[model samples]
Target: MATTTFSKLVVFAALVFVGQAALITKPEGPTIRTRHGDVRGMYAEEGAIFLGLPFGNPPVGELRWKPPRAYNKSWAPEVRDGTVPGPACRQPGCGPNKIDYRHTCNRDKNRTQSEDCLYLNVFVPRSVLLNSSLRLPVICWFHGGHYMYGTGSAMVYDGRILANKTNTVVVTTNYRLGVFGYLVTGEGEDDARGNYGTLDQIETLKWVQQNIADFGGAKDKVTVFGQSAGSDSISVLLTTDKTTDLFHQAIMLSVPFSITHKTQLEAIRVGNDVAKSVNCSAGDMKCLRSKPADDLIVAQNEAGKYIANPFKPLELFMQWGPTVDGDILPRQTVDSFANGKIQKKPFIIGNVREEAVLYIYEAFSKPMSKLELDGIMLAFLHGKGPVALHEYNPPKASDYRPFLSHFATDWVFQCPTRNVIRNAVVNGENDVWLYVFDHVVSIKSIWHHKAYCQDHVCHGEDIPFVFQTPLLLNLSFTREEQVIADTMAYHYGNFAHTGDPNKASPNVYTTGNVLKSPLDWPRYNKRNLFPNMNFTTPQSVIVKDYNKEKCDFWDKENIYSARNKGK
Candidate 1:
């Protein structure tokens, strides 16, 4: 009798173990259905990631230089793999895959890339698949590489961590670049029409609107964010009606507003120069289109060097960018905003305190003398070098590069951005918030620290902290740096959910992270001139106009006029 009882007890224990095992589910990739078909995406503890999804048809062969063709969805209900990443658009100086992304793009490397690279990646919370009803905010980040370099798939921009941390859907998209995307020949249809890249961005946003709901994203709550050239594109979109109903708010970082959209005539001259360099007959659109892609890219590299600022000495800036067609762009960015063509939405635009240091620091062998600084400043300030020099006499730092960095930062980034926001505020448009990133880390400490930023925060330094990519990359982050990463992500996530960046609640991302400050970020006002946020370690503070005297001089003197710069 005892042996029979023991046998029954053992069988009952085995059943209980099996039942518990069934309750603990294993991790498996999820599949979502779209208009085309179903796509299987990778699932991790971080988020559900869908990668390498093409939103536009291949813009190759005859479709080159045209607006993004519609995506062909002629598939049955079979599942496609979204685990692999797509190739980045063809451009020089792009770095290798899965390693360091901020390096030179195609520097003597046999990297995997091609012209057919207009794709995007999406990331959502891991639990969204289980709870299909959970609708989250969306963030579409436009990768910035001077509009000529970079891929949305750079590991640093992988959206899994950001999505899981913020409880939002994050998107990174690829657009055409350089001559392939922006080469303009005065003629419209058969030849190069400009703004194809911007159009590509718009198309991606449209796709997000149409399909993001299936992936649990709030279609109406989409926000577009970018750095550098991406910000410039956002600035252009703000003035145009092309992006209506696609995205609601914007976050622009380090907007170089001084680079106005080129008019058709101005663009024609530049385009003609590129054509001539490629050995094509004048107005022979057929011959230009027939050339191989690489040959055209080489031609652009050879002749794309002579773009000049008539009033200044800045060269090789934006030769091929947003062109102001009479129909699309209509006019330069500032004119459109001043005429109240702005879409009237909440925005955040800012720049680093030392914006230009990263560009000029390594080019110099010795300390940059004041005379040399004045020479460089002339390129940006034009004939107003002396006036600016008198106003921003470099403080006695241990090094002199900061002075040169300061001069260009003010004219190109700081002052112009301030003027742009001021126009919005004075017009009684939607809210405008300003910030200046003053955070700095030591080169002796952080891995992959560029020689350009020794003790200073160069341009786009806020990206890593905001995305928390350093953690994803396993780079060492001190306690303070970790806090900074948390703070930026929290505020940015807040902005995507609500228009306000600092209306913070609990920090579900980290135990120690908290964002509700004693004071809310004051909006930009013309009368009282309230202070702006200073993003730094220990804690950020509000400060009244940084380099106020110089910014005032630049605005009052009208030194930033595109007419003077030969726009």
Candidate 2:
């Protein structure tokens, strides 16, 4: 009897090994027929597969900076190992420094970067793709690193979590950054032209439309979502007529449409100044193009000191953002939205309660006084400081000035997000849902020096929660926090799958006195600004006005300041 049992066990073990081997090796070289050619990818894991395919011809040498052309059909079969990520676009800096100034201008970590970095990665659930009948929704992400740095290869943006949790196809692409992406030389030269980055994105969308179906995705059910500059790009795409058919829905995490023509030109002048300082002829595009990438990056960083908001200057070398090129952007995003020309689609847009706290934390060590706070209001509000003062009076105590940063929060981020919602409802285009993330982790000590007291939900803090990546990075979360992440991810996935977020059904989490129902969150009409949905402890919706009048006043004042340009 013992001998017989041992033989049976050995047979079972052999069967299990064979099944595992087959599962790992069976799905090898799955072919995908694209508009360009028949390319192949392979299975990466149990529920994930990746394809690193090129969507356009390499924009290098003579083709550099020109609008990306279609991939040539006559080209030979390039043996692509889709398992490896591609190089990022030629740009300055590395890692998070790609967005912030952690390195010197002389540093050229990205000198090895290639202009040929137009590759895109697709992450799909193997189960969905293997089942030919299942047509999953696709989420195409654009990474955010100030439009100058960041790549599809960044680990934080790995779509595995998104695909596994949401059961959808996820894609991330690399586009031109920095000088290669948005250097606008007033001359007719290709290098001087702006919006190259936007064009690269459009091309990737085109690729999705053509090849996504092969990966068991509905080409028509594409939802473009992004954060920070990526979110800014989504806003632009929604406004641009050229991208109307490329996507059906958009999720903008933190959109900022602060760029104007005057500001963009100033940025160009900064590039020219850098060129001249580096001994390259400012007038000669060829000479500037020939300069070493590192030297040019150093010059650009040196020139940043002369402009306010060096990363996003109003009218100088500091401005590095999308331009209203007549072909790609055609007009400012705000103007297009206000004119009711933007794509009519359901949108889910909101910001952290304390966004400016992050910026203030990075810039200053101390809090602002009531007088200094009034000055800031006046600067953004164009003499409407007194009205703002009446609405949002500073805390009486000087020690509580740190709390005043919330005023900056509402003025810059929260207010603008609410404005977008208001405009959408007022225009009668689509339904809009508003959320205020008030969940404050006990990590306040981590931000002690930034003066970010209270439960200041700073910018970009919601990303990890939304992606459900707390454990992957060894971050701790309570059972309740895990529930919030699950709920948020569920809603996001449902939104991408369908035009309406209500399809997710029964939003059981609420803050304040608000109840979690499929239709309880009313449209944000002016009459009822209370009952804003809060994501915090007890999860109840409550009727509390978040000083909307003060926020609106600041918005109008900023618009006026933008228009009048007082000397």
Candidate 3:
């Protein structure tokens, strides 16, 4: 009887052990199942990070100069490693002496460059991912390098800090640059149309729309934001009918609006120059496509050096970009916005205080004389030179770089931005806000080798503050600088969340990163005094009619009048 009782006790103990084992679940890593494959990411203090996820097929071989195709290869049974960043797209390497204030060229030194560079990175806060019901707003970023250089994987652009602070998902993507992306020969079976890079951007947006739900993101709440060349790309994308449903809001930072896109004839000329450099016929697309990417980069650089825009001489500086393709890009950005051809959405557009100082310092090694300034004005405006010179006359005639910088600022960035904003408002688009980043960068070495921008609020200066990268780099910001950085992030975060810069996110308190600014950002309108937020240290304030007279003059003269003549 005792042996039988012991046997029964052993059977009961075994059953209890089995039941307890079934109740305890095993801990899993930060693994996400995407449509392309199952990817294993790493967990940082703030969130789960997925790096180097390919959204499109490799654009190599016969796929060169073609629109991007969706990534279809699946790694279903096995998990793909996404811990390392992908290679940057093929571009010309810049030396240490070049104007790499953003340190993009140097960042490429650490990563490889290849034609298969259609990859993107994602950052999701830990709390959002763990909670099944939390779906955060998404901010898709595009980096700036004049459409010539830059990768989405640069260290300075890491989206972890921004994701953590804003409690949103942040995605940064890579697009082709220079000849590989924008060269147009008017040949080939596909016609070799330009704007392949912009197509890549659209492909990325499609990927986000399809896959972001798995990463705790709201597909309908996506906001596209960029700086400089990236911002210009957004302006072009705004006009395209293809991106109508991809994004709900936009924030263009320091768009170079005066640098008009190339016409079809001009693009063909540039393409011919490239082909000629490589010992091929102007119309022979097969030969151009078969050549090595490195060889093509050299040819594109050579072509850019000689192809000057007669209508706007300054446009030669940015010769290779979006072409006015009749279908995808209906017309120029300014014209499209003015005619209400763009998708109706809320947006924030702004420029820095000294947007042109960086370019001026790079162009001229020494200060300019009054004679040289007059010559520059004539070169810029042609028949209208004298009038422009009189209108933009400097108070201190001897030291004219400051005024020259201001004139270039108004012409290239500030004035044209205002014109677009006003046009958008008048055309029944009521939700638009304007701002000017008026604070100078406090960190001297962050300027890379170009120390000239240390004292001025130059182009690309607002980026670090927006990303709050100083904290990521173990560098410290001054008390005032920290406040400004927080304030910019706060406004941008709010804009991403609710499509209103002044409305704080309801979930902001959950992240314990609540941000506050004393000033209330006002929507831009003709009746509201055209208030523009001046972002600076200590506090940000609103100013009315910023550069009104200069903007009005440029709008009247219409530097891009050639676009209308052709239309």
Best-matching candidate per TM-score: 3
- Itemize residue pairs with steric clashes in candidate 3: none
- Kindly state the number of residue pairs that clash in model 2: 12
Q: What TM-score does each of the candidates earn?
A: 0.88, 0.81, 0.91
Name the lDDT value of residue 197 in candidate 1: 91
The digit string of per-residue lDDT tens for model 2 on 1-567 reads 111133433333344435664543242444455545545555444244454567778877666657877565633365445666666676665533443221111122432356788878888664454455567888898977667777775655667667756667889887787767776766465456777788899999988887788667788889898877788788878877788788888777766443343344564676677777788776567777677667766776676556633333333312466776665676666656656767888777767666666666555566656677666556545445566677776667664345555665675567766666667767876466667776765544334444454466776666656655445545566766765665566667767775665575232122333222333454456666633555555442433545577656755755422343331
lDDT (10s digit) by residue, model 3, range 1-567: 111133432333344335552454423336777776678776555666888899999999889888999998888788888778888898887543555545465244455788999999998874554463578999999989888888888877888878876788999999999998898888456667889899999999999999998788999999999998899999988999899999999999999887888887789888889999999998687787789988998898898886445656776657778889787778888888888888899999999999999888888778788888888877777777787787776675665787788889998899889988998998999999999999887788787677778789999999888787777666778877877877887888888889998898755422234247868899999788999999986788899998888889988877644453211
RMSD of 2: 7.3
Task: Estimate, for each residue in 170-281, the C-alpha lDDT of model 1 and write its tens digit.
Answer: 9988899888788788674576778899889999999999889878898999989999888888888887888878899999998877766676766677777778887887
TM-score of candidate 1 versus the correct structure, residues matched by position: 0.88
Q: In terms of lDDT, which candidate is strongest? A: 3
What's every prediction's RMSD, in angstroms? 7.1, 7.3, 8.0
Runs in model 1 lying further than 4 Å from the true structure: 1-26, 95-111, 312-315, 362-371, 394-400, 442-449, 505-508, 511-519, 526-528
Candidate 3 regions exceeding 4 Å error are: 1-29, 94-109, 395-399, 509-515, 560-567
Global lDDT of model 2: 0.62
Predicted candidate 1, C-alpha RMSD: 7.1
